[model samples]
Target: MSEPWTLHPDRALPADPTVRGIAREVYAATRDLSIVSMHGHVPVEWFAQDSSFGDPAQLFVVPDHYLTRMLVSQGETLPRLGVGSTETEAVEQDPREIWRRFCAGWQHFRGTPTRYWLEHAFVEIFGVTQRPSAATADAIYDQVAARIESPEFRPRALLDTFRIEVIATTDPAWASLEDHTRLAKDGYGDRVLPTFRPDPLLHVDRTTWREEIDLLGRAADVEIGSYETYLAALRVQRQRFVEAGARATDHGHLAADTTPLDDLEARRVFDAALAGAVTAAEAEAFSGHMLFQMAAMSTEDGLVMQLHPGVLRNHATAPFAAFGPDKGYDIPVVTEFTRSLRPILDAFGHHPAFRMIAFTVDEDVYSRELAPLAGVYPALRLGAPWWFLDAPDAMRRFRESATETAGFSNMSGFVDDTRAFCSIPARHDLARRVDAGYLARLVAEHRLDLDEATETAVDLAYRLPLAAYPAPR
Candidate 1:
């Protein structure tokens, strides 16, 4: 039989003896720092309800696209994993069976960040000793299922256990924020905050845009008939989010364009969209204009703007239709930020109240565009490597690329951007380890003193995030 899998204490540290020694010390200093997740996709309801997770499969396999997408890649069906299934399609009802399938395919996750996180949760969080395999699938599932039934495994309880100082949940602009209100009442309001996402409101071409517009109007208690009222509704909702303890607004667009149109042209496009006569070109232009408007609002309201563009969302239409959005079909595209965001940056780049963290999957722009932009602009900060680039090597490459130009302070530290609640600490842990390794190399090279490298590591792990996204006063 194969030996049981075990995580190394110095995992993800530099391989060189000199650098590794420095890395070990650096990693130890920030290993237990309080996690500051300023941007993420965790559901606010999870904290408000403080409910126990259903089972091992429900907690791991079903909801995580990172797990399910890999399973789908290796000849598995979504329904079999307890994901979205049509009425005609048969769905797997047994959580045990789903867990078994996940465990059986354990080897498929080798060399993936998902693999590292799952192992961390298994060994550190759940006390699983045996490595997952077809033979051990049932036993591991029972162990995980039993562990999740404990009160400590519940959402809010896990917050303290994970040492999460602050975690922001992404919520739609039209959201009522009733759950956030409940959390505020429960004294978790400051710890678990909301992030306003206005993608639906900006994209006039979407099929649900009209419905979302009406919902926004009702939620903001505003009468929306024209572009002016639409802006008013968005402003009202943003204020509501701020009142609910939101410190930032999140935007994800296909591109980072922020050119604004004249009032008449903007009104014309809005009227056309309202009349269901807007062309695709017109809609795209309107979306860009809305982004500029969002920036202007951010300057006024002090909500830090976070823009992560350059994704061709729902690349595989078939999977999107079957499983709905965020089922792991979003593919990265070559994103241009310098020319595309001139309008917004030129307007608010030096504004004292304006702040924006720019994120990208396109590493090509790290040194060439984003780093240089952030290095100079007081309002702009380079977001940490995100999505596909959140892995170990990619993260190292990001620091090597951006730190030279943008420097440590100009970076937004690390944003987990995760939907998996349990994976939060694991992701932050990976980031902290990677940053320590990078700083260790600098120390080994004599470019930075040992004390300087340690301070920078602590800043990256804690202080930078707090400074980047300040809580609403």
Candidate 2:
């Protein structure tokens, strides 16, 4: 028989009895709060059309880089897991086989956050009572498949079930946002919003930059013949996004540098890049300058600027060439935020209209760099432990490191930056549990009172995200 799978009510709480009790109280106080997903990659079309998801493998294994990357590390090829290949080649075409492969490698997820999230979904969302393994994979897949076929398991139905008050979907600068508009017309405007992501347009070194620039110009109905025109086109796009109900702009760059260049120098670099003659160093410099320009735009338009830097994307060329980006080869490197952000922060750190949230995968800079910066700058806030550091211990370390300096208010709150829609509730629940445990220890030590911890828990789970990324006025 397969081992029974169950979720303990007090899972993720402190091991000590007294602290555990305190944590339970704290968690219970805020466990049912509505989610405010300020930044994510979930396609808006899913919710707009209220689409029914595919089989278990399609929902769980195929799209999630978190699972695919781990399986890849264990000698399992991506193609075997239903991941599409870059070259013209056949891959595992059966969803059932992909599900079986995932189950067979379930042991590899032991002691990882991926295991916790998956189990939470299995027990709480799908009502699966048997542990996933090669022996029970078929049974569990059938059960999940049946559950998802029901109308109640549709994407819109699941959104309501997940208690998601609002979610922001990342869109390219040139996106029409037709789905977002449709949702708005359907009276779901208050619930779903768009986030502008201009990475492809900003990174001149990429081969797709020229195409993206043309796309942007066409989207904005502007002719971009100079650097000034390009900036104007970007401004127009931001306005379009704001009109479409976007409250934030998201940037994922290789570095956090935001130094501005003189108009002449910037124009010169733009011309070289436009001609496809720019060097790597010139591209890096131009990208850094664009960060400053983005901040300037945010100051004028009131869109929250979210910067997540230091990710070396597509570290391995073979897989990236065969597959596409976000195949889980992105790795974090040491990032220096303090000096790099000085130019932009110095320019608009105190501007009332400017709001910036800094996210980093480099934990070494949390207390030493991010907290200190956010603690002082009125416009700057620290984003939650993100991407690679969204695990249990890493989150605890973030709170311990940041709270003493920046306090709870400086936090942008828990953002479920995931493409896996069903995993949203599980990810947020884990964050709440971790925060409750952290606060419980503080209350036990008399650093905070129980009532205060309860209120803080609610804010961390719900309120802060709204405050950080408020609906655009």
Residues 335-397 of candidate 2 have per-residue lDDT tens digits of: 999999999899999998999999999999989999999999999999998888989999999
Q: Which lDDT value does model 2 have at 46?
A: 92
- Candidate 2: count the clashes: 1
Off by over 4 Å in 2: 1-3, 86-89
| Residue 284 displacement in candidate 2 (angstroms) | 0.4
With a 3 Å backbone cut-off (N, CA, C), the pairs that clash in candidate 2 are 86-322
| Candidate 1, superposed: residue stretches over 4 Å from native | 1-3
Residue pair clashes in candidate 1: none
User: In candidate 1, how many Å is residue 234 off?
Assistant: 0.4
Supply the global lDDT for candidate 2: 0.93
TM-score, one value per model: 0.98, 0.98
